[model samples]
Target: MATILSLSNVNKNFGALTVSDDVTFDMPEGQALGIIGPNGAGKSTLFNLIGGTLAVSSGTVQFAKQDVTRVPAAERCRMGIARSFQIPHPFVGMSVYENLLVASSFGNSGHHDAKAECRDILDRTGLLPKANRPAGSLTLLERKRLELARALASGPKLLLLDEIAGGLTEAECHELVETIKGIRDSGVSIIWIEHIVHALTAVVERLIVIDFGKIVAEGEPSKVMADPLVQEIYMGISVDDTAA
Candidate 1:
């Protein structure tokens, strides 16, 4: 498979602290990759670097065969990279449909039939019933759906998901996971950073574990999660107690 995204020798430094250190990986086109780590593990920082919300202190970010290390966030969005934040912060005063329209206007750029596009996105994200509801009135799961919908409004080729399953009930997480599976099956590449192991494993083809800005493990989900060191350090459990 062709590579859709690649990070080489990536480093992100804040003053003297290295939040992302020598990170390197390649995402296969149209495949889902999951990232897991404990708190303060620099998972979010890695996402920011890929999504162009933060610049790499040193290294390269190549997406769609183009070097984008210096690209601005909006330019990256237009280049078919779009992401949902860890927290859903939609335009609270706007209706769900309207919020998607706003996102399409900026992120999609020059797309026609915007209404139909957004409507379809709402349906895909399972938010069609709440299309006219104010974003603020929706529940946590609904907000998360809206965030996913808004990212789709941009027509992304690569979607970076940041802790999207956070704070969801089991049933709600299942719903979102199914929706994400639908997206993945439809051939959109994904890199999901999530703490919910089962939810992440359900969708991703491969898993990478990060700690203190470095990847401690990378391989099949079961294999990585079964590593004794990873199990002890990240999950705080010995390998014998549980199997991934």
Candidate 2:
């Protein structure tokens, strides 16, 4: 598989605080990579840099073999890179279908049948039945589904998901896992930042653990979770603490 996205020596700073420090990785085409980390680990900041929502202080971001380090967020969407925010913020007044239509229009670039594309996205995301309903009236699960649907409507080749499964029941999360698996099977590469370990393990082929703006482990999901450093981060207790 060819490298679809590459982050080399990427660094970001907010005044004296370093959010991302020398972060680097290569994501292959059609691969689902799961990113797990504690709060304030800079996971969201890393997504901002990749999606062009924030400027990198150093290093580079390449997508589909093109250097997009300086590209604007809208342009990145046009280039087949789309992201779903951790929080769902759909247009409160618009119908579910209309929300997706807005995304399709913004990222169309005259290449796809936007109408058909929106319909397909609705179907894939299990939102077709609610197409004409107001987005703000939906339940939490429906809202998250709509968020994923809106991102898919843009026809992205690389999708960045930020804590998408944060607030959901086990059954709802399982439903989402299946939906994401279908998307992965359709050849869209995904980088999902999720705290729900079970959901991430269900769909991703590789796992990456980040702490303090740097990678501490990468490889198989189960193995990485069992790593001492990863365990420490999640358990909130160090090895010494356990020993004592």
Candidate 3:
């Protein structure tokens, strides 16, 4: 598979504080990658760099084999990169379908059939019944689905999801896991940063564990989670935790 996204020796800093330290990775087309780390581990910062919301202090970001380190966020969106925020920030006043239409127009360069495309996204995200409801009126689970739907409306080849499954009941997370699996099956590459291990493992082919802005472990989900360092640092578990 060809690489759809690549980060080489990436670094980010805020004043004297270093947030990302020479982070690097490559994501192949149509692959699903899960990222797990402790809070304040710069996981969201990594997403910001890839999504063009933050400028890298050093290193490069390449997408679809093109250098996009200096590309503006909107241009990156037009270039087929779309992301959902850890916090769902939908347009409260806009209907669910209307919000998707806005994303479709912005990300697809005013595609003529934006409404049709949004309808499809709503269906895919299991929000068709709430399509006409005000976005703010939806429950937390519904809002999360809308966030995913809005990103999908952009027709992205690479999707960056920031904790889309956070704050959900077990049953709701399971439902989201199935939806995400369908998305991966449809051939869109994904990088999901999530704390919910079961949800991430259910949808991703590989797992990467980050600590203090560095990749400490990466491989198949089960193996990565089982690593002594990862289990100790990120999961805060000992071998006995598994045995128990």
Candidate 4:
């Protein structure tokens, strides 16, 4: 299992507030890594650091065996790193197909046939039927799917997903889990930051729990979720104190 992305003693801060504290982790090729934590646990901030949306205060970030701590976001995307926002931000005036076309053309370095690539991603994301619809008209789930399609259109080896399962109906979430499973099966590595425990449990081989900007636990999903510290940090005392 070769490493696709590695963070070594990474740290980030905004004024006196520390968001990521010496956090370190690795994603192996073709594996899914789930991140869980309570609110304000810096899960999203960690993604920002990895995707180059924010500068690390200290430490190193390596992608594909190359140091990328100083790489720009666009360069990171071109280097096979792509991410979806926690909030969907589709191009407001653009059609869904057009949105993906832009992602294919620009985000992917204009290296692929934008139309074909866009249609393929839209189909995989279950957005094909709505391809010509205006992005601004989509419902929440559709918006989220479009967000994922945009990222996928970038053709990444490492995909950073931020709560793509959030705000979906149970059936929709299940559908999304299957979609993600297929994506993983295709050999793209993923680091998913999500609060939907069951969704993650179904798709990820491993889990990492973070608290107050630091990793608290990392292991197989069940074991990581059952860890006492993880229960305390994510599920609070109720989970830790519950009877067997």
**Each candidate: how many clashes?**
0, 0, 0, 0
**C-alpha TM-scores of all predictions:** 0.93, 0.93, 0.93, 0.94
Over the full model, what C-alpha lDDT does candidate 3 score relative to the true structure? 0.89
**The CA-based lDDT of model 1 is what?**
0.90
Comparing 2 with 4 on TM-score, the higher-scoring candidate is 4
Predicted structure with the largest TM-score when compared to the true one? 4
lDDT of 2 by residue, 8-117 (tens): 99999899999898999999999999998877889999999999999999999999999999999999999999899887888889999999988888873453678888
Looking at candidate 2, the ten consecutive residues that score lowest on lDDT are 235-244
**What is candidate 3's lDDT per residue for 103-150, written digit by digit as tens?**
788884446778787888898788999999999899877888898999
Cα lDDT, model 4, residue 140: 85
Worst 10 residues of 1 by lDDT: 235-244
Q: After superposition, how far is residue 204 of candidate 2 from its true place, in Å?
A: 0.5
lDDT per residue as tens, model 1, 1-244 = 9999999999999999999999999988998999988777899899899999999999999999999999999999988899998878899999999999987988845568899999999998889999999999998878887889999898889998988888888998998899899999989999999888999999998999898899999999999989987887765522422553
Please list the Cα RMSD from the true structure of every candidate, rounded to 1 decimal place: 3.2, 3.3, 3.1, 3.1
Which window of ten consecutive residues has the lowest lDDT sum in model 4? Answer: 235-244
lDDT of 2 at 135: 96
The alpha-carbon deviation from the true structure for residue 25 of candidate 4, after best TM-score superposition, in angstroms, is: 1.4
Candidate 3 Cα outliers beyond 4 Å, as residue runs: 109-112, 237-244
Question: Cα lDDT of all candidates, in order?
Answer: 0.90, 0.89, 0.89, 0.89
User: Hey, what RMSD does candidate 4 come out at?
Assistant: 3.1
